[model samples]
Target: MTVHDIRAALAADKATVGTWLQLPSPDVAELMARAGYDWVAVDMEHGSFGRTGLPDIFRAIECGGAAPFARLPVAAKTTVKAALEAGAQGLIFPMIETREQLNQAISWAVYPGHDDGRAPDEPLRENRGVGYCRANVFGKDFDAYMTRRAPELFLVAQIEHIRAVENLDAILSHPRLDAIMVGPYDLSGSMGLTAQFDHPDFKAAMERIHAACKRHKPLMGLHIVQPDPEELRRQIAAGSRFIAYGIDSVFLWRGAERPR
Candidate 1:
């Protein structure tokens, strides 16, 4: 039960770039960990990985030294609880639109009985990371488990709506928010230009997000398909810290698209 310091690692210039593993199998997660990613998100928002398949993926991420984060379908309490209990070290809620939703998202992420306002160095939050029965009953020491698992389970929110952009200040100012990710597709749609990455409105939205993020200091992420190395470098230069490079199906479709 050892946890990887993903935030510190990211701060130390360790490229935490990872792909979205939409597949149900743990093998993909294991493979990505072996590839030395900082973390991998099990895409429950779009992937077919329901309750049963997600646990194995989370375990695989731990075994690989890559953090396990789940992109829940929404910022619902039950969904977040179930994912965390299943051993997901972090969460990413999709289609976020308001500050109220962000606060609600943190409410679901933290332990139910404990107060959420603890000093950073305190162990209140750490004590509440009671893992699932499988991990707990397996005779894994809880403290060791937490030392390895608790602190790293980041609560990330995806900001995609133009309304969210309008309320960016309030959203980013929430104390519990650990990171913010951009849903480029939904964002483009929000801008009235679906899937057009080159659209002026889309670029403007990205800039606004980047600019607003500077004020809050949470990890900022962008979603890209078939991302190039140079583009990754450029984003890092622009102050983006979290990144999702590709998804499970993209690997398959891109492989199929290879020029033979």
Candidate 2:
């Protein structure tokens, strides 16, 4: 599905489901993708996989007709460039608490003159290194991809701290921001309430963030890390569009039970 499909689902109060991948194996990636996820995000930050085999993993996912996404550990330009080079169609940037961080992360994804008017605040042009890579079929489609299609990649800022909740408006206002996913554990941890999703403070923060997303156009996302069917339904009813349901490791230990 396209971003428009996600928006349509959100407009209808439906959820667009995706999953997470932490293992490096293309076998694992293909399996999850074939399992019917709209997208599968490789947890680069926490996944045991290194950068060398990202393209293979992504290819496997694509073969199953799913978009391959990356959950970046940090917003480093090199990391952003690497993931894009490896054919990541989407990116979930972690621990973003300020507009500057989010802006820089977006900048790294877009090439020069293709900023799409997103970095007006930046004193410099986009620093993304244009190169022949798997994303462009290794220069086969480089010209067209670099000039226009590259900007079509999905970019998400992960809201994982109380500070991000507080600054939602500024962060969400970015024209280049495609989506925002809530890292509930990190968000609660920042509030001195690690993993305490039931805490009133955490609940309040979620409400604020959700409201902020509604006020803006970015698709609201949530990580249902533990794969609770009831919780997933509840969150979808409450308007989460980009939903990450199961981690690859969790599916391994718990067995692959398709979410309802």
Candidate 3:
């Protein structure tokens, strides 16, 4: 399982760019992958794709040489397991507001015995191990997959709620958490200031998040919906290593409208 080098890039404080796939078409996914994004996330929360359709899209993205990631609808164990089994090299768990939630999300994303020397039949059996799936090439690649690929799986917590901002320190301190993705719209809405990116309180929230990221050293992620070069550069300058640049639908819409 060849994966993107996002983990090392983020660890070394280098910028990594990715795009969101909101459309359900594998062709669109492949196109985005081939455009040279470090990662391509399938938006299960807002996209038309569901569990049944995820694996194929993941395959398509991998075919184009980009790591496949999934933005889960919620931080649920079943959803995380399903996405991992479908070949998502990483996950973006939405609406995280507490340390416990982040911890649970990490637990679900990782195989228990892989980190700790616990038996599969231990007291927490069901919650610990992942069954043979596409992630392990359906058993053929189990050894290499566990030893090489699993360690690089990225686990991101989306900080969308005001409470998550307030609890940022504890959430960032989670040992297994790899990155923090900010959902500006949802964060603003949580603060009763929808779409007010320039509002003082919203700016303050972002400041706190950046400070926490600096303190904890996990990758700080921001979704630059417009994909302007200057804005991308600005975000990278501001310590955001995980940059998600726009969605598939919007990119297509804009490209279609451009004069030939």
Candidate 4:
């Protein structure tokens, strides 16, 4: 489906399940996309793929008919712009703690030219002049893409750090933020309860996130490291619209060990 379809689903509060692709191979990306994921995120932060490697993987994912997303290492302007230019229909920005940080990310993601006259705190309105990258079909479909597809580009703010959790309300208030994903491990570490998913502190943090997302407009998302169908269902029932279920490596390892 197109980015427009994904955006519509999120707007309708529909459950969209996706997988994490960290193997840095277009083949793996294509394989995962073909497996019927609603979306696939190219994990650049923790994965080995650099800026140069993203386009091929994105192409492969699109070829297999799944929307491609990029999980950025940093919320820098250059990183966000490059990823979008390379054909990421959506972006997962990690470690965003402040409203300013998220605002900047949205500005870089949506604005193609400098100073569209938006307020400093507001993201630019136009999605033109992104300069003929893979996203616009290498300039072949630039106008059509800007006017049609670019508006549907998804933007997700990752609530990982404790500070982000504390500032959840303000962060979620950003009108351009399309979704919010919680990083359980990082949040646990931030709370001084590293890897303790069952700890009260961790569970409470998750609860706070759920409440905040329900209070806001953006879709709630969770990254599940293991393929637990029951837990996935529970999260969705709890209002997690975007569910990122497991990484490529973990799935591969589990499949390999299943016969043993």
Top candidate when judged by lDDT against the true structure: 2
Tens-digit per-residue lDDT, 175-246, candidate 1? 767778898888888878999989888898889999898888577887766757798888888888878887
Candidate 1, residue 33: how far the Cα is off, in Å: 2.3
lDDT per residue for candidate 4 within 24-134, as digits (tens), equals: 999999999998898999998999988888899999999999999999989877888778889999899999998877776677777565332245656444343357788
| Candidate 2 lowest-lDDT run of ten | 1-10
lDDT against the true structure, each candidate: 0.74, 0.86, 0.84, 0.85
In candidate 3, which residue pairs clash?
none
Q: Estimate each model's TM-score.
A: 0.86, 0.92, 0.92, 0.92
Candidate 3 residue lDDT tens string, 1-260: 23446766665778889999999989999999999899899999998888888889999999988899999988887888889999999889999999777766777776656552233442332343667999899999998888888877887889999999889987887776778899999999999999999999999999999999989857789888877889999899988988899899889888889687
Q: Which residue pairs clash in candidate 2?
A: none
lDDT of 3 at 93: 92
Name model 2 segments beyond 4 Å from true. Answer: 1-14, 116-122, 256-260
Q: Clashing residue pairs in candidate 1, if any? A: 2-148, 3-148, 89-153
RMSD of 3: 3.3
The positional error of residue 244 in candidate 1, measured at the CA in angstroms, is: 0.9
